[model samples]
Target: MNLTLSLAINGGTGTTKKRKQLLRDSIVVDDVMSCDGGDHHSRVVRLLQARERMMAKLEADDPRVAAAAPDDGSGGLRLMHLLLSSVAAAESGDAHAAAAALHEVWRRASFRGGDPAQRVAAYFADALASSRLVVRSSSSSPAAASAAPPTRAERFLAYTMFYQASPIYQLAHFTANQAIVEAFESGGRRRLHVVDFDVSYGFQWPSLIQSLSHAAAASTSRSNSHDDGDGDCAEPVSLRITGLGTSPDELRQTEARLARFASGCPNLRFQFEGIVDDGPDSGCIKVDDDATVVVNLVFPAAAQSSMTSSTREEECSALLARIRSLNPSLVFLVEKDGSGSGGNAKSRGRSSSVLPAFTASLRYFAAVFDSLHECLPADSAERLAIERNHLGTEICDAMASFADYNDNYGGGDDDHVAEPTATSWKQMMERAGLERVELSSRTVSQAKLLLKMKSGGCGGVGFRVIMEGEGGRAMSLGWRDRAQLITTTGWRSRRRSINKAFC
Candidate 1:
């Protein structure tokens, strides 16, 4: 996976002497440069030179370099430096050098254990050949224009890979489980109806199903104990999961997976129905009066939009209103906190720009890469596969399509816009007439425990969960002291009446 060694011995562009000279010059400049009163151009040049030095240091055999692994920021800085160098090279019209730099970046990122390095290397090499250094619109290439969307296998691979390093799925699982438990305890109906929006793979629901099954079993046992030789004390709690997805194959797969997980719980009767429709507005979602409904919106399709867009805002409001109309007992919202296709736009115009999106992706994935480095060995094949197939694609796409990167990356569609911030989501939910439900201390503790267990080998990897803002309703998950994922549960509250006076 070490690109430097391979490139050095192979027929690379630079001669041995010239390469050594470049390295020496970069080191000398790095040692001598200072940031005191320089113009913008000079400052940029100095920073690039410093980045070159950092890259060299990363490749060195020094113990200090190994000691400064990603958890400490040094390794992440080197990765960022290589990325920036690639961008700078591309900007300067040196496509060959830019491609080479990007190769090195992906090589280093592929260090975590997963698949064979050759597999990852082959993908990067092919990507370099097929795509230009800059991101191009789908219309720019007839091949891209006609390209089919990612298959279910490809989607599953990408998702499982991403989950290796990120705790997002786990956080969402915990949040959803807590919401379900609360709904069962507070609501009158024993039958729970869960409406999951865009339930890709249905990974989050299995744990909730299992938990409810166990709870039902315990309740049944207690009821039997209290029975005075009577036939029955109370009906067993039943679960009905309605999965929403756009693809029939994916929906079928989700239904099958959930059914398999539900089969083991004898005390809990479970039913699964998959709906193929756009979303809540499709008239597929049904609200039953006899059951307690829980709307699980884990990374809903609509949430992946630019909240700044008036059209998108209206759509989001409409979708929320539809869910509110269901009168569900609880709604679980889980989302990435960092900017990208899964983040919030601070202002209206900036959401479409490439630089901001790229910067956001960089900061978000840096912590992600660092966490992966901490948990897995440098040579782990799983880690390599995840980095190469998942995160690497994201970084490269961002670099190529600085502006409209999300659309370009997702193959020209608004369906994959950057994620909004937690604060922005809170505002959106409040406007939709949902009241924030503070995440329980038990849920927060479980989140912390999950992080601890995952990062135990790597000494925690600087994972922290915090309750932010007044009343502590906003719960954020952070890595390396930066909040990268935020999730909170909300419930529908009766609207407060507004007082009016006659003029």
Candidate 2:
């Protein structure tokens, strides 16, 4: 089975040349980073620092691994799903298949159980560890046989979490919740299912719960106050949210966090479900009966990474096609910003066995942090300090440690962090037939600046503060809590009118 799956990935041809070409064609390295011989020493250093900080935080915060954690992480089904899927996939002898299975495992897993993300992370780490130690023959040189694989697990975990940062989630959820509440108040009754992709830490959806609860309460309050003996009143709003993740622990954590949120807002009711071990499916996002499902999965373009080869394009296409078929009110997608240079597309003069994209991203982020520390003002040093306090200093250090791992493995330096933009996701959503409605950005450069100030003990302000004084809020102040790359035709008018009045 391993041989078969490997063939499936490498193509049936036994020639190394064929495999290399196939990898190059499927995994567009240029999409990851564009190297221009510029001075990246500073950037690389910052990344190392951030990697260290993040790792320390993880070690301190994870419940299973740590003696005590900051939060309970009760609703982490997404994490569980990933773990189950990875184990299943490994057992089944098809790595990709195992990864794919995580979607369903996440969806169906209990909302209050083990964490899927951590498990899957561990699984990948363990797998890589095994791969690194697997010596096929004594004839191989000691260095060749004993070399370690890249820190693929760490990179994957960090990138996945960073892809859907807390702020982005807050922004996106803010917008969608507003729209959803307005729809509900306008005599709209719909069953909403919210499926989050790569719900690694489950940090994104708590704000979503808050938004829904607030919206529901406002609608109820207005209804009670404005009614003048009108028997023909609009129906009360109802919302059912089904959240999907790759881990059971994530699902469970989500449920717990949301439950606390729901307790504060009685008008809104929600049922959160988890699907274990599956990726986003087209069938899941179909909107029926005013059902507006929002998918906030942050993944590198499949075309850019070996983890998601060209064959998986069908999966991406199918998922989008299903969402389009549902014709929901809105769909938002977000992706990491890449350097505009196109060199990432060019194949290196090396072997085809590249480390997974997530692993590469981890190194890249670590580099960003290290770079920021060196370049930013000393005032922003508090950002690193606070991060160290909350997360740890190991965040950046992990990357440096892993750099050796990458060098020892087939992984090369294909890491870079560009200003954040939504271009790639915009294209994908457009192809999926979703219309454009809104776009928001928070670039890595800008984030670095903010973190700099934060490090300086300025307490860090929102992005809008630069223009709106010390009290500036987000441009879309009350929109979704998650940042979004949205495309929806004919709906622009509605948003424009709403913003004009609200602003």
Candidate 3:
């Protein structure tokens, strides 16, 4: 069955265009340095020193280190120290030293349960091979590119590997699921449609499908109780998901994954269709009048820039306007919490310089690495692989963005742009004629609980729900109160009066 949806693009003229604003360098740089009380250079130095200390502790017969097994917390700490040392060395231009550090990391990390050990070993091997090539090349000649652009399989591997090491995906999925549940319950609509923007691997929908099934069963049970002595259950919910992506293969993969998930959910009837598109424009989205629609934007807005534009305002505004026309019951937006030059209004006019963007990226990834250090074990090959493919590559890409030979290091023409901040997204949503709906207090509590469960009883990570720009709301995930990631939710107001209040 063919199920495609579209939204009309409004072409009304005379709409006032607002002047673009850029984030101040001082504010952006200071925000990144605040957590470590120093600049990015100093922070890197400190991390290296800490790595040395950790190495010394590992060499010593410290009771904790001795008692710790390869897969334990201490082992994870050791692995993290080695990984950070390698990164520091590579960043400092000691490619051979970085190779050595990676070797040690691979040797020390455990590979007992899964193929992570093999994957991490392969990554280290590749690094060592690249280092050898760099050493063999003429000092005066530019070095050749060591690797090709990532294939689709490699990209998918990197994406999944990143999810294993960090809580960002988990946090995003949790937030989105809460929003979905709230919308599903409150609207009381028997049919629900979910539009996932840039759906990669369809990882966010399985749990949501489960929740919908449970809710459907509960509602049916209640309806049966209220019926005239009838034992029959109420009608099942009809769920249709529309996944948008640029690649037909990736979209089909997402469909397959979701189809499998739906098969397990017998409480509701499910349908899924994948759409290949560059952006959300006319004839790309369809809304059913009898169904409540929820739009899910998870880390999709950051890469919306084109070659001619660094600011995502125009793209974001157009997309939001189209979505608003559909009158979605809820819009779930999740983005990284930094001001880099790529994604939204905050990054406008600053795409030429790389230092500000690099600093922000450094600070953000540092918190992530620190969190991983606290949560995973040194012997966990999965953690090592994740760092190598995900976090490690991110740090390298940020540095390469500023280099004169950036193209040699897999840097594209658009690599210098800054990322978006939560505040910028709030403004963009408001401009698109959407108002923030305060997430329930229960949702906030659930987020806290989810973090606690993921932290492995360390209590190192925390979050706070803050209100911004009228009724707009944002939840920040941080380490020791330093914000790392922000997930925000927006809703279309049914009453015109409610919309005017935000204006």
Candidate 4:
């Protein structure tokens, strides 16, 4: 979430920032840094007040005053301009101009909080407001930076809300399950072992277990060792998940939940083995030689890295190497897309400035906030929890660190839209000797159905799934016309899969 935290794992582009100033959205899931705690204080409110009166005076003659303005009707374009101008000013380090722009934006943005546009405005206002506080405090004031970081539990809860509210988490889990099933069926392996890198609440496994049971049940003709060789009944398929977690208690609770869920599933043999992650050696994860193996990488990170660009890349590369060693039949890469070129091949190899990259990143989150308006009612408690503890916290960290986000993503034309070295995640996977693979039509259809069902208002109008990369190997879930938000890609170790195919 921290702009300085080096956004990784995600790749795509909506529009060129140079031609239309529409910045690329990079998918980053870094830890949130401590905030100034003053953005919501009386001082920031006072700034908004002064700007309100000034805005009234200036727009008095203009027919497009806030009082008469419809959120997306008469004043939408103006409101958008205000946000863009403010971003441009902030990116250029003109704090005074940016503050003036933000004050006006905050008042108008706060007007129709329920409206999607207004919601986007309000979220951006919070981010820019926090960033302003950082600029003013200029370090020596410990009292000003006393904001508390959101706890692991809060993040987990928020992650759950994210899962329910959108296809973000589901896209990863569902697509990964497809490949896992393929692995199990290809070899007709009786036992399947999944090693999840970070199994926080174990929200990803229930659906998979259900799918496995249904598959096992449907194939009544399949041979079953326990059925006297009659073939009328199918034996329960063995599923053992080796889940990694940061806390033992969380691990226990997760195992219990999965165990209870699996009990209801028929023709299924399920067991969960929890391990205290503590960044253990990848080799430590035990795998039964007879069981097919898969790895789940939902927001993979090699430590909550705060290293230089080269160091971060090295760490990620090494992590991929470790995964390849596991020789997982498949590796699912799912990450939040909140920064970088939406999907421009031309700009995928260039570099970027700190503020420009962060400013451009705003478009992705804006679409997300706006789309949520369609997903849940304004009064929904789950929606509120998501906006506050989850999305809001991410915005704060990303915006607050923008001015200081100095890492060489390489350099090129100002508007050329660099994608962190031919894009970070994809390149690393290739270097790790992982071959890109396509997701199934079933996976694609289900994703579309999910978007339609969740954001049913106006038919989830513009939400779409786009297949990118050579041979269209990756998929991205995006809002409206911009196909940049969450990205999911499937991969397999080149050597392992190749040798297995020949054998």
* Selected candidate, larger lDDT, 1 vs 4: 4
lDDT per residue (tens digit) for residues 1-503 in model 2: 00000001212223333223323432322122223435443333334333333333222222222221113332222232233233323322344534343333333332122332332233233333234211122232222235343353444444343333323333333444444444334444545655554454555565556666666667667777888876444443345555555667666866776667666766556666555545543123333445544454433233222221223345557566544544445444433311111012211122212222232332223223322233333354333332222222222233233233334543333343222122233345556555554222332234334334433322133211111112321122111111111211112111211111000
> What stretches of model 2 exceed 4 Å from their correct place?
1-191, 229-236, 279-287, 299-305, 338-427, 440-503
For candidate 2, the TM-score is 0.44
My TM-score estimates for the predictions, one after another, are 0.69, 0.44, 0.63, 0.69
- Which sections of candidate 4 miss by over 4 Å? 1-105, 128-133, 136-158, 218-235, 246-248, 275-283, 302-308, 339-352, 378-381, 400-422, 452-458, 469-472, 497-503
Candidate 4 residue lDDT tens string, 341-408? 32111112233333223433455565666566667777777776787678877666666544333323
What are the root-mean-square deviations of the candidates from the true structure over C-alphas? 10.0, 18.0, 14.6, 10.7
The number of the candidate with the highest lDDT is 4
Residue 177 shift from truth in candidate 2, angstroms? 5.4
For residues 168-223, could you state the per-residue lDDT of candidate 1 as single tens digits?
A: 56776776688677777788668898888777788887787778878888888898
In order, what lDDT does every prediction score? 0.55, 0.35, 0.53, 0.58
Better of 1 and 2 by TM-score: 1
Taking all chains together, the TM-score of candidate 1 against the true structure is 0.69
Q: Local error of candidate 1 at 43, Å?
A: 19
| Model 3 agreement with the true structure over 1-503: per-residue lDDT tens digits | 00000112222221111000111211222233223334435544543444443333322312222223243322433443444455445443455555565555555543232333223323332333344221222221111144454556765787786665556677788888888878877887889998887677888888888988898888888888788884677888888998878788888888888888898887799989888766554235666778878888887644323222333556666676666765778888777643233332224333332323333343345445545554566476656556655654554443333342222332333323233233355666776767778777777777777776766633354333443444436665555445334545656644332121000
